[model samples]
Target: MEPGTARIAVDLLGGDDAPAVVVDGALRAVRADPDLHLLLVGPTEVAAAVTDALTPVQRARITVRPVHAAAGPAHHAPRADSTVRAAVAAVRDGTADALVSAGSTGATVSAAALGFGRWDDVRHPALVATLPAVSGPVVLLDVGGSLEPRPATLARHALLGAAYAAVAHAVAAPRVGLLSVGTEAGKGDRPRKAADPLLAAATLPCGARYVGLVEGYDLSIGARADVVVTDGFTGNVLLKAIEGAYAMAGGPPEIGGAPRAAALLGVAGTVVVCHGAAEPADVASGIALAAHLWRRRATDRVRALLAGAPAHSSPSDSIDTEVSP
Candidate 1:
């Protein structure tokens, strides 16, 4: 194996096409990264599918933690011993450096929060997705972590995105923006108007600065900001729309298409949440993302940055939003 080994715990029963897709993805990841090791968390039969495909040398780096329960429908609460939960437990117990799951986002989030513990001063965690922009990568937050967010939550997302951009993507002096109807200061709803000033006044890490409100188009082009903050409902819709548009255009940009996976911030461990309908390539990408973040020590660095920022107070009356899983 190569140096800098990153052991990632993967939930084999997490996605819509469990076991098969997960097995293929895990096999691809192992073959691609010489330093990658996997602790497969699922049924023994499912785990066997992955191990059987690898050569003896490759198979030596694989371990299996057999947990048969899968993350079911979004509405059904996560079982205590679900595969995703077991994956999280593996990370918490130092058995793995990170985790990747193409499961129900809510279940994965809940499992991670319970297992890893949230960072201080962060009530609602953020799921951050990086889009390949024209100028560079744009970090967008709250893609599905918190569907309904208060103005304070949006500001917190700005902090998370800014730090994440710097820590993960190595963006220097990242520019932050709030997604709104227009770039004008007072063009958005109550939450945007409220968040604008809060973000402007807040202290950003890695020399990041708030660049006022930005439009949806800014997310794809990256002409205006390096980090865009919005409630999970809006961000999720926008991400899906962009992905669909890429499909309609024959293919994604040469750099890449919209990511089908995202990193969950606020929790203490390195956790990646892939789309429930993820394909083998998407699951493989998610595994790579988790390993990259773990190697960079991103979760710890981002949390430390937030620790130095001022606490954001949550408001009593917050807007509620919803999306289908």
Candidate 2:
């Protein structure tokens, strides 16, 4: 376990079976890591149940912040007034080192981006996930953070994925690849076509090289590309399909399936997003992931790397605080 106290604010009402799964996951995390503390954001009664279930010594490591919003509540709510918004505020206020939520992806991203602010030139932050590979770990980005992909955005994601692999996963030299239907240069749709040369021309960090293109199998087996980059729409669907395939294959490979939780990149603070349908184990992993990201200072390190990189095209014109419904 890490030494410093990693205070993670968890959204107790975020998942489909929230409060129960959140409580169970929080308990598991607390018991597994002695130095970890949690700021539970949700109903007070639910938080109390978690505390009551813990031993006296263990109870001391938890803190409950109520997000009791009466019916028909207005805007300008307090941080401890909404489960996900509360978690975001906890990080912004320095009360928590990181945050984990299995809530609405759009809502959580909007709250985090509005509360924590986006890094320079990052229009829409990407939901990045790392897959355990035989060679090393593979980093996949834009897993539903943004659906539309511009050529420049794909190039920028390459830089982000390369830096993240180096900083968070400790991959010395990462190989970045554009996700496409075929490995050939002219294989994908218009976006892939536009992005191919852009990624080729881009200067990647951490000694990373841009491999032309990789197929869907590359994502599962990890034979090609240590980092797979694509638009959030495609990445999200592909991730779920891979997970389903693993389920159909009896179970995930011994190596592991595509992760259900993803790390939000381009934000100022460490944030993790679990699948909206996450169960107890998935929630626990989300918390564990937040702790891992906080310890690694993944967000800060990635931002610093991008600050020094060459200029990309302008950020997306739409900077709306509210995400698409």
Top candidate on TM-score is: 1
Candidate 2 — which residues are off by over 4 angstroms?
A: 69-80, 314-325
Q: lDDT tens digits, residues 1-325, model 2?
A: 5577789999888877776888898889888888889999888999998899999998999988888632112233324357788778888888899999887787777788888999877778999987776777788988998888777778889999999999988888888999998998899987788888888988899899998899887877678889999989899998898888888989887877778799999888899999978888888888998998898888898889889898754342222223444
lDDT of 1 by residue, 1-325 (tens): 2258899999999888887889999999999998899999999998999998999999998999999898767766578889988999999999999999998999998888888998887666899999999999999998998887578788888889999999999999999999999987799998788788888888899999999999999999999999999999999999999999999999999989999999999899999999988999999999999999998999999999988887655441243232334
Q: When superposed on Cα atoms, how far off is each prediction in RMSD? A: 2.8, 3.7
What lDDT does each candidate get? 0.90, 0.84
TM-scores for every predicted model: 0.95, 0.92
In candidate 1, position 280 carries an lDDT of 95
How high a TM-score does candidate 2 get?
Answer: 0.92
List candidate 1 stretches off by more than 4 Å.
Answer: 1-3, 314-325
